[model samples]
Target chain A: GESVGLHLPTLSVQEGDNSIINCAYSNSASDYFIWYKQESGKGPQFIIDIRSNMDKRQGQRVTVLLNKTVKHLSLQIAATQPGDSAVYFCAENEGSSNTGKLIFGQGTTLQVKP
Target chain B: GAGVSQSPSNKVTEKGKDVELRCDPISGHTALYWYRQSLGQGLEFLIYFQGNSAPDKSGLPSDRFSAERTGGSVSTLTIQRTQQEDSAVYLCASSSMAGGSYEQYFGPGTRLTVT
Candidate 1:
């Protein structure tokens, strides 16, 4: 089981505002991390990923920050849009295991008010 | 299929009945996976398949749940004597290889409702 957990279960932000979601992971062996967005009645879509070697990675309007010392990871969305209203999940892939199995967090629901 | 595809977008069945969910992976994806999401919970890994080889079913909750991949393209997840607790959305994903943990495409998922 993955110790990855979100600090907030639900978040509400106004249109064009920034949204930040935080996560904590317990497994230090995990080398790969990913964030996914899931809409109602749909599967999760890959958003961004980061490796343990790096502290931050940016893609599109999203940024992922990893703090190995604190075992924390965060996803920051710049200018959060109404379409960004969905559940976001943080996942970890253990490098040592070499298995493709991903340990996923419960998820944080982001509700953007348009 | 261009991406992973699952059958019966939604299913409603009575308790004690059996159900089968299907998943069709991409053209050449060799690593297939099954997961279940209940309510507001995260996805729970159920099983993993690699080509025509054996599958890793350690994640299966019990023997009541079983899955099989045929000819390395399509797969089926069968549940026997289903209970109300089995109600949830079942998702399927496929990657390039079993060892490649990189980006995996997911299917729309099958929403199973047990009454």
Candidate 2:
């Protein structure tokens, strides 16, 4: 469990096991959410995204679940590996129009243990 | 098919000095953004640019912080009278479109250290 607008929390899981990282966003008007993965010393790389219309979306080995009621979002990685270890971030699109401005939540550092 | 690129991957500047960071967005991408991440902190939205439209400067922290995108291609984020608190990794991202639904490609980022 994580709080809104706080420092990043960490999740450690053994290799081959699934890992779940949670985020609580602050805005109720946000209609889109995105998950990103960032390796040490690198920028965030987009992992998966889901619109408000959908509660869940799946990608290769990754799944994003959104709960609008609680403003909570989670990223589940299947069969986590060492290469999958990174800081996971959930961002909300607060822009009402077509602009891409985003408000990011505190990230979760996912550590995979071999 | 190049991704977003940032220059001066590392910067060390004295307090009160000014620093400029550059970002080259993906080819033909119409949206560019700047974000700052302090150590152990999440990304902070700074500014955003969409094509030739006026940029959204609402996220800027203060009057000393400013940015500009020239010719709708490259963007520069300038921090005037830099302070020690300005030390952080500055990240740049670009989206193929100007909308929130599109994915944003990020650069490696510039690490700025103000002493």
Candidate 3:
């Protein structure tokens, strides 16, 4: 069985500040990880993804760091803005079936204060 | 290009009633997945479809839940005798099999409420 969980249920950050959301996964076999952002009344949008072979990947304003040793994943947002406020979720692909079914963490609500 | 789409964005039914939700995957996508999201909770895997092969229904929570993919494009998820606990947002996602690890595009989702 695989379980993905977040350290904090919510995170509040001042505008223009850096925000980091953490997650831990229990399955060692999980190889691929993804970060998603879900705004109110919308579906989860793909933010970024990282393979087990890689330790870190960066997007325009976000970065995902994977630590396989401890089975941990993190998403970092730079210069957070009000629009960046949303629930962030981390998901892992078990890779056993290859159907790309992902197990998602509960989620961390990131609130950006102006 | 259009993203994945789900019909009946909001559905309301009484308990003991049956409901069917629809999903239209992106054109040319080979994989489709159904997930349930409860209020303030994460996505729960429901069923998965790949091409014309037999679907992987390992995630279906109970016998009352079933889904089918027709002609490798559209999918329908049916729930029998719905309960109040069955209320949730049903999300559908699809991905192409390019390179074996494609990103899934999600639909707006169908909100099912059982009164």
Candidate 4:
């Protein structure tokens, strides 16, 4: 019954603009979260990750915000570029499980318009 | 410096045939994982292996699916009597449990098509 899901199936953004993708997770025991980007015909690439202890984590051009209260997670991309267009996924790991298995969300298609 | 690698970039097999997918994890990584990605869907966890511990077979979809990791390095996922619904991209990933980073580095994936 535990699952991760995205708020939007597709999100379009203008070049140079900022993009925000939202996700909602049903598991309260999830302590670790990760955001991944997948280009067409390629494997999912690690973008950023956040632990339950931290509310936010930042990477080069991306940031992941985790709201434990609402069981919500979001990925923010600054200065969205054509290269940023890809399907993004949010995944979570149950803290109590030592196996480190991850449950992934459906995915959000981020489309950048020039 | 090399990352995870999977073999036979793609495979097409007839229904009811058996297929084996291979994965090579990064050097020094003690954790290995297998996932399935259906078209337009997120990655589905299949199984995991850590050190010499028994694999966590909880994620395996059915008895027809089985995997083995040799010497804590190379891994092979075998699907017996595949069905059309088994068509998907199989991804392999590895992470270092030493640091507790849990960040899994993924391979390019083997696209399996059950015809």
Each model's TM-score, in the order given?
0.95, 0.94, 0.98, 0.97
Per-candidate clashes, comma-separated: 0, 0, 0, 0
List lDDT for all candidates, in order.
0.91, 0.88, 0.94, 0.93
lDDT of 4 at B1: 94
Higher-ranked by DockQ: 1 or 2: 2
DockQ of each: 0.68, 0.74, 0.79, 0.80
Tens-place lDDT per residue, model 1, A1-114, is 557899999999999999999999999999989999999999999999888999999999999999999999999999999899999999987545756678889999999998
What range of 10 consecutive residues in model 3 chain B has the weakest lDDT sum? B97-106
List, residue by residue over A12-105, the lDDT tens digit for candidate 4: 9999999999999988988899999999989889999999999999999899999999999999999999999999999998655856778899
TM-score (C-alpha, index-matched) for candidate 3: 0.98
Candidate 1 per-residue C-alpha lDDT over B40-70 given as tens digits, one digit per residue, 9 for 90 to 100: 9999989998777689898899899999999
Off by over 4 Å in 4: none
lDDT of 3: 0.94
TM-score of candidate 2 to 2 decimals: 0.94
Give per-model CA RMSD. Answer: 1.6, 2.5, 0.9, 0.9
Instruction: Give the candidate order by descending TM-score.
Output: 3, 4, 1, 2
The interface RMSD values of the models, given in order, are 1.4, 1.4, 1.0, 0.9
Q: What DockQ results for candidate 1?
A: 0.68
